[model samples]
Target: MKIKLEESTFGLLLASLLLIFGGVFSSAVQYDYTAVIDCLADPLKPQYNGGIIINPEINDGVKGWTTHGGVKIEQRSSISGNKYMVAHNRKQPYASVSHKVLLEKDKLYTFSAWIQVAGKNTTVTALFKTGDGFEKVGAVEAQVGCWSMFKGGISVASSTPAELYFESNDTSVDIWVDSVSLQPFTNEEWRSHQEQSIQKVRKSNMRLQVVDQNGRPIPNANITIQQNRLRFPLGASINQNIVRNTAYQNWFTQRFTVTTFENEMKWYTTENTQGREDYSAADSMLAFTSQHRISVRGHNIFWDDPQYQPWWVKNLSPQSLGPATDKRLNSVVSRYRGRVIAWDVNNENLHFNFYESKLGGGITNKFFQRTRQLDRRAMLFMNDYNTIEDGRDSTSSPSKYIAKLRQLQASLGANSVIGIGLEGHFHTVNIAYVRSALDTLAATRMPIWITELDVQAGPSQAAYFEQILREVHAHPGIQGIVIWGPWSQNGQCYQMCLVDPSFRNLAPGNVLDKLIHEWGGATAQATTNDNGYIDVSLFHGDYEAKFVPQGGRVDEVSPQGKSLSFAVDHNSSGQVIKFVSHV
Candidate 1:
């Protein structure tokens, strides 16, 4: 029989039905709802702790490990759980202890350890098995001194077992290690952490504007903003006419964020390019660059290229070599102590060593020590080339580079060598190899800079250049990039020029412009939305915001001025700056 049910009874009946079949109904609803939360867990995210390397803390007295060349366990209360491993090598150049660990294919693994050096420097090397042989995944050098943390990692290209070894090059020092760890992380997690590290330390920002006494928006004004202390140096080499040529100057200011005087600042150019210390050009260049707020990189205090050394010093005997080295370092570094950002103390030590032969092996240490003393603020770098090129298995391989750095650290202490400069002169690049090289160098916890990056001129030059720049920018370990090619009129540059001398963008230049303005970082432009407000996202740095009367015009001469200038900062949130146009 058909019977009418009251509203309350029907509601109760529906509630009862929902209680009984809620699970199925909920699933059906979720299937139809497009905005539902993803119920699946991310597989890339590690679900468990990575495989353990036995005796990582040396808690078991070096058990579950192969000891080679005077490896022993030390009991120290300061260390975790009061125990650590010490590899003391006094006779031979090699001493190490390694623990084998299994790693997954196509996964990123990071290996780290707490290390202390007593006499000289030591290194932690990671090796993986490949068809060819044991390929070095990465190596990290520990500075000689008190306990320091060093780390390195690799993305396993295949399913292979890896070994983490701590090696002391010689009997020069006692290497101590503890708290070793091999951990796996997803790319997303790694990049998220890196972003945290990058933004953890905030710099103060300034918000400025130029206008008349009355508040008005000045649009399309010529503006220049210079950073006081450059943590990142995105720059390019300036042409010979940088100071005089309008095109060159405009291109330098608009495109490059950092400045490297092409030939004017080099040792040969400054001291003896003309067989005399005619720094007239260099002095003028430095002044103009400084005024424009472009940080300069001391290309070289001394050039080791045998064909490029000054004639007077080339014939100098061993006795006078040290003094000549000191004079040159003192003269160049002392003059621009606070002005230039970093000094390429000895250029390409890996490629040549004229000074080493004449002044002995101590020249590098002395150069660093003297540069440190003269300009304590500027970083001292040993610049080199071919360190991260496609064919790296040859002489200037990453392993060879790591070994050289270890020797320098052993003699000069870790603080002496503050930066690693790689002249990224590329014909072709193996991106995987480049990433591996950067990972190995990052272990030292030093700033890794692409000091002279430029691709060879080719049909694919633009593509290759863009690819390299993207890779560098993607890496958190990389500090900055400085291109070493000029925008020559005839496209005959040292490498690939970014622009034509007519100030027109070439292919490479187009890619670079996109990276700088659209992808890498961005600038915001909009008229005040009734409230004289515009919002923009910027990487932490100094900025110059130009405002003018917006009517689709670049610039216009007002009774007061053509445009207004504003120096503004986005250091914190909720920042509102006012610019009263005096013009």
Candidate 2:
């Protein structure tokens, strides 16, 4: 007898059977299927060494390895018989052990390794030397005594022979490496993996059973399931134009269920004169969103960039700036306390520190504490740019972001509610690096939101936009996404616009609509089997289900048919809804 089950259940059952049979089924699986199992698993010490790198674990004493820039290289073993490669006696920062590998064009290669420094902590970057120039794969802050996992990837336009190596600016420390891996995947394979992830993360399996009022099984019953609202917050940014223009309102309301006011809620716009404040524009915008039942994310309470601050506030002394900021925070958070769902408490603190440099080093912590006091229910976020967009900006790298988060958490206590807010403004999308960065930040287990996601204007803008949206949506760590594109009277936007001046759909807008429709659970019809059960897969959201008897009309609101509502969110599991029929 053959039985159908979910992939996870099947895997567990297969593993149990293998354990009982004692190696009978082990040899049948020859190829590495670990990628299919968990695509985001640690690249270092992967289940299979399928790449071109020889003796990746240094098991064969540095075989197929050579020195770069005349650096001394050797293989060493720990007391536990674990082997690793080390580059020492380096005269140049780029001097390290290297391996030559053939890379195919248009293939995405993800590289990872366990790296450590012999001395103090320093940044180590993985590089690929191709015909064009040196392409940076990824980087990690390597420290002494412990190993850090370095991850990054590159996609080439042309097939070429490339040399892979590691570089650290501090030439005084030796770069220790182990458990290296370089995995390549085609674009099609990458998309397939994304679909697989969406199935596992964003969807759930439901089994609905039909029965009579007397609890008897009723087969051949008609069932209908329709999505009411999507729980996943996929939205776009909006300016004050949405409050006035009917076309803008209709365009936005039809597509997004969540939004962030472009500049209406910012300090410079709200309190430009410092002493006098105006929230009429913001208030009107909030009212419109509230009437439409759309959720709003508080764009920010305070901006850390000096350039973004009000002219009057920037020149004030540290003592005066402290009280003014206090007043600003209290005014904003208290007014929109329960209105907003999440707050970017300190905006762009990782890049600039206007408040920190002027008010004091501990001003950011105080701002968060004050915001929490004002709105304890809302999630606080450290919203910043380039954290995942670019790998070169170590200032807002995932590691540095986490470090800053820890500092804030340490001051706020153990149970503080803080979130990772990545402002994803991209010129060119780096798929592997984005995934790796999210994986690194997911270790904190805090809620993460792509607060300001936008791809710059280019021929590949729409394609890159779709790629980024799919990648983030497929990842389980991301909670929500808000595009940075805000529509205006003119056909202009921050970097990318979804619609033209007529409020018609552009290329990116079409992609957005396509995904929105695809992810939604449009009305589906099915019939119960012999056991009076109808099995179906549904996306995570609120849904409405209806049932009708064998000879009953589904359109009629009579005793022959019944309707019910249920939610398919992260908490939903093994859901079985039984509907009682009057027939």
Candidate 3:
């Protein structure tokens, strides 16, 4: 009764199934599972086929590869008969194998390679020596025994001849590389991939069929679907101004279903005078958000930056600092335990380590453990900036982030629930780098959210904001996004503002509104077919459907309109709902 089929055979069978079920379930959505299977089956294999690199597989004995920076290049084979290129006896960091290739102007090129090291683990960077200078395309931590895949890309502004090379800072280790690939894609092709990913990940098909009591088809019924809530958490940060300003409340509540206070819940804000505490502003904001059914992400429990600490706590001894931090954690976390969805436990821990430097190295782990105990339902996040926004920041790179996460996991045990919160504050958007960074972090399989997203103020600010939003939303790894821009009456914002003083939308605000509309914020209408069935693809959310009998007056059929509530989610692919008609 059981059968095992080869990949090609399974593909043929999948095609047959599609043909067989395509008409019988015309209203249901069909997904091609071949790609998923292929990805999971052989992840170490190279994905690019049309790359420009010559002798990428090393089968021709390193015909196209040459020594760079006076190193030795040779083609070697493994016991399994797999050929690879090796660069040995390195004197400098950039001493490795190099390949020259002509790159096109205004094109995006994605690079990948399988690498390993002869001795200890080291970070290997893939670089391109272009007409301008040396450009780092990608990097990976190469290990001793196993092969690791390095993925990254670069966008060129002008056509130039470039020499692609690999580099390792450790001169004692020999680098082994295989399956080198450099594939280029046009802007249109890249956008098309994003759209396709969005359609597959964020949407589901729903089929509505109307029938009489006797199971007879009631044709020509008008169906109206209005989305009530979007499941994807697209929200913004808010300041205390929202508590009393009616215009501010309206503007915020209309678009966002989630929010985070700008500063109300921080340790410095709540306990400025050490023993004295205040939660009135935070309580009021929470009340407003609770009334509107908006979920909140706790802005922070503590800040690692020395400048952001409370004035009174700065001069405290280690003994006093420990107790004071415990009190702060208990007061805030216990006060709003079940109300918030996530907590930025130690904000900017990677960039600054005020508590760590004063208390000890174990302070952050202790805080995370205690926060989990206090608010068991909330996700504890390690939030930091520049991990994805600026790849040049080695202090908070994706690899470093993962290393910190692993250290915490080792200390907290395997079952600890931690979230990755990247504060996406950017100036000029780098689309390829962003995607590659996300891909690298997503390998950990941890829940990732863009905690504080904003672009610097400029003429291209709106465009960059739109690019970031689209790219993050299209990525399946990103679970949520919260914009950092908060509105003020004087038009002063952290970096970018969605609206001006008069409550009119700014350019960035307009971009957000347009995207919200495209992602199922607008009401839609459709008519049933001859079989009383209507199929539609919708973003995952709560929806209200109204059925109007054909040829009947709008008010004549039920004044309230024959309506029903339904939900569309990832598991709603073949979901069928039947509405009974009295007419």
Candidate 4:
């Protein structure tokens, strides 16, 4: 019956202590249950790096791993990547850089590096394809190297795991690839790899074929090829989205990359204004051409005429205006220095009042000197209108241009000048004109190009297109044709759009498939059985080609005809031999 203070106090303290401990234990249990786990393995755990002759592995401590095909690994010292302990270098052209990583196709991943120029022309790349559909993805740049980093990335194809690649040109190039690895994302670890791959490929920059109503790679759509390699994957449908945006890039535009302008660089654009000397407009236009992957001709840098020369310069003595003209030449040529495939240093110097007569002879010489000074790489061309137009023998005019070209060469050395361009801007280009021009320019025994030939397609569109293609293809001296005004913006003068204003196929575009089919070979691969056939690698396009019972060497066409290009699904399977004769 006696109340004990100790007992009461002890019971209260015990009860309170138990409640506190229970609350703490409950929180610990809840925290453990809700915590996120990381099941993804770290990719960098593997060993890779080596050197060639001196030491085999990438570096002294670098390790190597294997995948498909034969691979060689070695360590190559580089000017850059000096901070990095060592560099992993490989020279296999077929598979320059390949990695097996945990990649869900559509996920956003970045593969970047500091690549230096090891050769005259070099490219650093990463390649991968989707499904049996074979949709490939990679990156390429023209003439880049060590001064800075060359970077590229693309979304991967959905579904099938691809042989991811990074390759470069055969021309000896030392690419210091550092910080090379796959990127991270939230959904890649948790969600579907297919969706992630789809996003990767969808956001990628490489061109792909379009889909049909059935969501298959469009069969006959034209896409560009690069470095003698097929643009798209062998069996994958090209992402139509990729092509529409990339139609203008140089190599990625189509299998058949061509010149859009022939000889439109003229007095109008160059000397449009009077005394106000200007070249920013021309530079912008040239940059645009380069960006769109279009090549250009110089037109005529110095044409003999009252209009070509500024009104103020005409009255001034040639000697007085020399500095300003030199400045003009330097600016014009330098702005488009390497970008221009070729340039007409002085147009029609022999026929018209050239800078030689007014300024002095060897003015063409000065022009070439200045051009080479800025860009020793650009091909200096001497172009002239009418010398090769209308099927007439350009015996007099072309002969004169050639004579001057020869004289220039004689004065300098044989290699001083690279090529002689013949401007063939014609109202109606005839076979005779082509022959006459070639015949005259051939006398010079120099490399020649048909600078501008706008073959009128009013009534004779089909005939003219066939004739031009055949003639140009046959000419040996002629390097290539630059068709001026090929597009609407360019062809405003000649209405040269292959697809007319109404978006209809123009004369040239209509029969172009046939020409390509005849010349383009069908390098068929894979053998068809119950489920078609299989081949390791096949180039893209319609494979608009024909092969004999015994197909010639791999990637070779029959003597009967040229192999045509074809479109294949990046994800299609089997030994598939398409028997279509014409594209």
For candidate 3, write residues 28-108 as lDDT tens digits. 221111111111111255546528888888888988889899999899888777888899999999999999999898667
**Per-model CA lDDT versus the true structure:** 0.61, 0.80, 0.81, 0.44
How many collisions between residues are there in candidate 1? 24
Candidate 2 lands at a TM-score of 0.88
Q: After superposition, how far is residue 464 of candidate 2 from its true place, in Å?
A: 1.0
Q: Where is model 4 more than 4 Å wrong at Cα?
A: 1-280, 310-316, 390-398, 427-433, 436-440, 489-491, 495-497, 521-583
lDDT of 1 at 320: 76
lDDT (C-alpha) at residue 485 in model 4: 49
Local error of candidate 3 at residue 291 (angstroms): 0.7
Q: What TM-score fits each model?
A: 0.60, 0.88, 0.89, 0.44
Per-residue CA lDDT of candidate 4, range 1-583, in tens? Answer: 2222234454344333322232221111110001001111111211111101111223442233233234443345445323221213444654443444444554444333333334554444445544553222323332333332222233434544555544554525543333343342222121122222222221121222233334433343322222233222111001112223334232224434434233234434455554455554555555555564545566556666565665656776777767757866775676666776677777665556646667777677777777777877878776666655532222324434555676777655666765776555455543433443454455455777766555554787666666665555444345665554444433353535454433345676666546444333333233323322222233222334323233244245334323434454434333333333221
Model 2 misplaced stretches (Cα beyond 4 Å)? 1-50, 79-81, 212-216, 547-562, 581-583
Which model is ahead, 3 or 4, in terms of TM-score?
A: 3
- Whole-model lDDT for model 3 versus the true structure? 0.81
Per-residue alpha-carbon lDDT of candidate 1 for residues 85-140, written as tens digits (9 for 90 to 100): 67654455435566777776744655555666676555544444444355554444
Instruction: Report lDDT (Cα) of residue 299, candidate 2.
Output: 85
How would you order the candidates by lDDT, starting with the best? 3, 2, 1, 4
